[model samples]
Target chain A: MVRLRLHLVAGIVLAFAVRGPAFAADFTVPPVPTHYVTDNAGALSSATQTSVDAELKAYEKATGHQVIVWIGDTTGAVPLETWTGDTAHQWHVGRRGKDDGAILFLFMHDHKVRIEVGYGLEGSLTDADSSRIIRDDIVPRMKANDPNGAVSSGVAAMLTTITPSYAGVTPPPAAENVAPPIVSGAVISMFGLFGVFMLFIAFVIVMRIIGSIRYGYLVMRKGAPAAKKEMKGFAFWDSSGGGSSSSGGSDFSSSSDDDFSSGGGDFGGGGASGSW
Target chain B: MQQRSWIGPVAVIGIVVVIALFVGSAYNSLVTLGQAVDAQWGQVENVYQRRADLIPNLVATVKGAANFESSTYEAVAKARASVGQISPAVVQNAVNNPQDFAKYAAAQDQLGSALSRLLAVVENYPQLKATENFQTLQAQLEGTENRIAFERRKYNDVAQAFNTRRDTIPTVFFAGLFGSKFNEKPYFKAQAGAEQAPAVNFSP
Candidate 1:
């Protein structure tokens, strides 16, 4: 019975240790691009890409917001929202705390489009606004075989919606729907504590043995009367022992100057997805 | 010998202080994670409420369509009512209580299926689908659904962190010291077949 219990405890420890990596392995989001406009699918013309990139750079300078256009081949079997939200979060597209970033993702082969608005930007660029942009600006132009017009005008509409204090943004009062900013730092720090936890477990087991030995000595000397209180405390510790430590932390330092990098923005899956 | 006597007591006191400090830090970390779990629960509720808030407008819009299926819209209204019937107190304390959390999730999932069914039924109504208002509502609904999924995933992530921290050995000792103040948070299991959204092709 004792051996079985030990095995069970070890199993729980292994389960917790193995859980984190299992989650990260499912969908691999690509690294954040150094450029504001990353046209992996070559969906946009060079002129359109350069103009959009310059406009986004200037906009970020003016209002600390980050908007990027990414054109990809596919997101594989992963759902569009899951992939986009994860990418936006992993990229940390907007300023830390402000979370005012938006990404316009166009998957060429998949024929899917999404305007993933950051939590802060969701207020200014509502889901309806994003949908309309895809419908009126992107979808029609894509249907007409004008990818450049589709991206340029769609970006222009987004900027116009959010610029000058999010003026002209309207309807649905989705303030209730927007997700709060996430604390990715907590996740990183949590991983470091795994090794600390392992040391703690070893200490606890040693302490437990010492506690029992002392209790046995007291019982033999005083017929188990006075040490009962101390024994109860040891039992409490015994009950709480199971489960393992955390591990594997990645450094997420955002570099400065000429290279384009995310300002640590957060997305709450608050934008629209459409396909043509 | 007198000086040597002080060494034993001093060494013991030093060890006691070190242990106290470790225990204190563990207690603090548990408290932080517990609070985070609560905050994430609030976000889940907020997004769920957003979906609930959209139901009335959606049902009304669908109701206007000629020869629309009354059964589909009625099921949505009924599911919405069931969702509303779950008391606020239960929702507030859901993290600490798995049964309540499961009940809450079930109600929300019921409403989800009902809403999806209604949308599927609307494919027959091309005229209703053409209206600008309906399209906007559809967009908002899609956004709201995505938000629900995103927020739920986040809640799970934080809850996992809290549970992991709470269950680990030394912290487990501190967690037990706090009584039920740090109950292991319940996680949302992906419902079979319901994890994927029903395909609603918007292409003309």
Candidate 2:
């Protein structure tokens, strides 16, 4: 019984120590792009792409509104717009802080069309307007098996409804860089830090043992103050490494100019979703 | 004999030190999580309060319009009253006590649904919708609704972390070993009927 309990305890520790990552890293939601139009479902042909792209570019150029479209086979189990909202946060779509991005999500296999309006756009493009666009403009084309016509006409109708805002002078070119994750090196280097730390701890323990053995006789004889000098000596010798590391850390990171990447956009989950 | 003589004291000291480290870390983590709950509760409260503050202005604006439904006005007032009715103690302890959180959430959700109904009613009065004050207030309310949703989502995430740390086996086992009183917290669930899309019965 004791052995069984011990084995169970060990097994539990082992399980926790080796427990894999919490969530599946499903790459279904791909990274966001600079230009509009991601037709993953192959729903749009070249001609359809050209027209849609032209409209989106013109829309962005005229006003800073970022209206992108996603064509996919399915939105999984969740309602089409909820998935789109989650993806919107990840993609950081629309102008930062302004929340002027809109996505026309088309799940081809699922036969769902959702118009996700960002918070900034919610004023001009109300739920009623989105629903009307779906009902009058997109659904008819979709039912007739014309995906391109549905998106094209749907885009055109949406453009008519959207109120334009000044995008300011569009002087700067869009910067595109695919950088690795921030903590990419930290995980690997952590093991080295841990090993050094553990070694230091072990050294402290050994030193304590040696000190007790050597100074125990002296401590008892002279009553505890005799080893003070020896401890201070050890402390002074060890602190320099810690001081150097922390001092090095005090200076800012070398590439401080562009450390963080984001457009400062926020999502409030105000959008209209629908299914055909 | 000499080495063996030191073994007991050394082992005891080493064990005590290791336990202190683990228990210290565990306690610190619990403290951090507790503070996180408090911080998020404040955030949720702030947004909820903003929504509450807008009610009087909205009510006044709605009242100015002629022949608006009194029942809708009554519902909004009652919902707002219920939200105010919940004791602050219950809301503060909401993280630990699911029942209290449920009651609080229900009241708040009641206010939310009533506000929705009220907004729907406002749609009938074209002149009211066109008013600058009414329009601005509508925009603010919509924004606040989104904020409350975001904050609630954040609170759930933090509470989940706390609960996971408290409930998971090895941590649970250690917490028991050390006699730590870490316990599971609750999530803020969406109000009933919130999942369904708002009725599209109204023709554009």
Candidate 3:
């Protein structure tokens, strides 16, 4: 029985040990979205849209990861029902103001891309860089029907040109990771333990009462001399014979002396009463 | 023996975890806002460069047609000279030298006035209006002006966002650490009695 109990306790402990670490790991930082679109209508003419679609299809064919491109107005509004197909998502690409253009892109992996280039970017990004990504990376890949290569090349070019110093900005990856989520496991365990402790205390008290009653019945059935003596003491105590005798002059003095001695013994006596 | 209770510890851990998540998210938001401000600043620089590049071409075209208007040519020359002098490095040191911004503002204002004068001169030349090259240059200049205005507004918007994040409670605690202080850059206020992009009649 002891070995079985030990085995049970070990299993419970092992289960908790495994679960605790998993709970902690669950609070890890979620990956930042990488695919996004920008709002620059000038950047996305019908020609560009065709190129984007072709690039996405090629990407889907190569990587087996579908890419969807949805064009919306300045404010990100799209008809939900039109977002059909197994691999398609909506995005906003329009000019907010004279110089303010936004581009939002979404990758199949739920990653997002956001590019906002002011009118100022036109001259800063040489026609070479712009055309290379659109023409060399995105355009031809789409035309040749190689979407995967196009997206990979486009993403690489974007990553290369986007410097940390541009406008004193750093990408989200460089930012410090947020703190882990708090664990509910510890609190749940504490409550469970408290509940068990209360249940154990009540069980102990109930078991002790049942054991005493059973012992009393066993003594009466056996007709033991000790049982008879126990009955006489209870009978005398109930009838007031023992009380009257104890209250009498010399007996009362002896009883008081006994009472004082017993009270003193409780402080230093090694004797203990067992319940079960 | 009573079973050991685990609920108290579990509840304490849960509370701590929630608090950690909340604080973490707030810090991340502040950092993102800082990066966005930086991105917007890049856009501002791009537009500024575009305007700078167009200045020489516009000046050359105006100089060819406005030979008789010597004063207008001089104004344009002086304004261009002043613009060239106000470097990006000087603007970066705006806090240490507040006067630099004033000087920069004055140069830009002078340039605006010079361009206005040049336009007024072109109004007198019927032959210049009919030239295809001159008309194209004029259209490009107008587009460049619109671009400049757009970039300025964008810069201001980004600046406002950064400043707001810095000044607001909780986030303000770390704003100073990032060197994000309130920068009082000069805004492009409209010149007194200046008409909006005036209609230039190019048809002779």
Highest lDDT scorer: 1
Worst 10 residues of 3 chain A by lDDT: A262-271
Chain B TM-score of model 1, please?
0.93
Clashing pairs in 1: A194-A246
* Candidate with the greatest TM-score versus the true structure: 1
Residue runs of model 1 more than 4 Å from their true location after superposition: A1-25, A164-259, B193-200
Local accuracy of candidate 1 as per-residue lDDT tens digits, B1-204:
778978998999999999999998988898899899899899989989999999999999998889899999999999999989989998999999999999999999999988988888888899999999999889889888888887887788888787777766667655655666887788887765443434435578
lDDT of each: 0.80, 0.67, 0.42
Q: lDDT per residue, candidate 2, A138-201, as tens digits?
A: 8888888888899988887787788433232332333232324766566758768777689789
The residue-by-residue lDDT of candidate 1 on A209-241, one tens digit each, is 877887898788777777786577665246334
Candidate 2, residue B198: Cα displacement in angstroms equals 2.6
Assess the local accuracy of residue B203 in candidate 1 as a C-alpha lDDT between 0 and 100. 74
Q: Look at candidate 3 and tell me the lDDT of residue A87.
A: 9
What is the per-residue lDDT of model 3 for residues A164-256, given as tens digits with 9 covering 90 to 100?
A: 132212222323223245657776687797787897888777765655564487587866676656555452114332333221112223333
Compute the lDDT of residue B159 as modeled in candidate 2. Answer: 68
lDDT tens digits, residue span B154-203, model 2: 67667666655654544554544443245456667765644333433222
